[model samples]
Target: MALPSTTVADFSGKYVLNKQLSDESKFDDILAAQGVGLLKRKAVGMVSATSDVHVYADEGGVEHLDITAHVSGGFTSKAERLEGRVLNWTDKEIEHPLFGACTTKSKRVLPAEVDAAELQNGWTPECTAAGVIFIQVVPTSGTDWVSKQVWGIEEINGEKRHTRRFLVTTKKNKTVYARLVYDYAGPL
Candidate 1:
């Protein structure tokens, strides 16, 4: 459970994936939609993940959230976003273990700014009230899919969980969705 003072608006802590509570049944399908190889997808299904998040503001007062995620087996990725005060996207090039070289960007966004309702709604009340962080990624080569994700905090089984909703769509229009739930570990 999250601390009483914690809220969707400022969830700064380390969280570990609760595989048992996460909606991972469609994870392989989402990976397939992203053109992940059969073996890679299988490997992904066996791994656990964690995210260390930091939410703070720069000297200029622009809020920023930095997330450092590590998937078991030594694979780690970092994502940075401009929070509530800014809605603009900040892009970066990363060599992802699953998606290969990709261009990604993230920003704080409102539900109306999201293209699909599935990606927009379905969050806990606090999540809807605090808004969400939006991310988009496109492989530099090989794959023809674009993945969009939304991050927020939600109440699951009475505990505040760090949740992520994924929407991966291929050039051929094959789309897949998945939800990831994480247990709050502690302050980062």
Candidate 2:
């Protein structure tokens, strides 16, 4: 059977984190290169994050996605308009479950166009401006490192859910992968 058609609007709702998995061995080097202390790295590997997503159109018919994510005992929120512009934000320091006080700087690039075909494929196309790809640069004690996050939606067990994948590539070209799976909690 064909999958049910999905639109950006289908993803609007509060989603609670259900599962998270990461490759620890691959993540260690990426964290170390980012100057994360040993203790903090351990803490990062254990923390869980949740997200809420909203999609709407503006007066000019421009599409926007507002996302709020709670992570490591703190929260960060940002909005991306599908106008091909980058939105930047610096968040206040929050108590991290593993790293103590932590602040974050992020840049988000929204899809320039929304393609229904992309959403149906179980992965958001990097070309279409439907989902969001964001890069977060966290400055640690010694140096700064970046984590790239891609957001998408997929149908799981006959229900559509929000998904996020994190990619952290070390200076030496090693890469680590982590994922967060969220289920719909309720309507917006």
Candidate 3:
């Protein structure tokens, strides 16, 4: 049976979801501070939403806060032997409106895997992955709250689209507070 999908929220192209004081320039500074070290591990910052440059508000009077923020901690290597490639992805799944995890793990590469020539000119490491892979870092370590996300697909007229909600929690061990309920329309 198909799931009962009632609402269709389309947050046009994309946007940034900023929390605290980390957005745009400040966000760039954070990356700069990491320098080459960034290639080593994972990092997090304010969710900055960037889209067409238009504002949208639902009938409820709440601003649609859906966005696709630029993420780092994607790929890096040393020793030059194709050690490992990383892919930093977010929770863009709809249905559950619950949680997500690091879909892709740092894996070593091989020459025979894909001709060295192809590797040198491969558009991106993600292109190498064989199947539909989703790389997301599940936020459930010790903190709580991972709700401000969804994955959307457009429709014919590009008016009412479909999307899935993604949120995370630490069992009953709650910490932060967040909610997911909005209608998104790209910038006009």
lDDT of each residue in 53-158, candidate 1, tens digit only = 8766678866676767766754454343322223257677777766779988777777668997778876777667667888888999988999999988767777
lDDT of every model, 2 decimals: 0.76, 0.51, 0.28
Order of the predicted models by lDDT, top scorer first: 1, 2, 3
Candidate 1 residue spans exceeding 4 A from truth? 1-4, 73-87
Candidate 2 C-alpha RMSD relative to the actual structure: 8.0
Each candidate structure's count of clashing pairs: 0, 3, 21
Residue range 107-180, candidate 2, lDDT tens digits:
33454432222212345443235545443534354344446655665555665556665666555665566555
- Residue by residue across 1-188, what tens digits does model 3's lDDT show? 11123222223443334233122343333233323134321233322223332123457754333223333233232111111212223233232111222222312232224222312222222223321111123333332332222233223133333222222323354322222222333333
TM-score of 2: 0.52
Most TM-score-accurate candidate = 1
- In angstroms, how far off is 156's CA in candidate 2? 3.3
Least accurate stretch of 10 residues (summed lDDT) in model 2? 78-87
Clashing pairs in 1: none
List where candidate 3 sits over 4 angstroms from the true fold: 1-8, 20-42, 46-68, 72-168, 179-188
Better of 1 and 3 by TM-score: 1
Runs in model 2 deviating more than 4 A are 1-6, 20-33, 41-48, 70-144
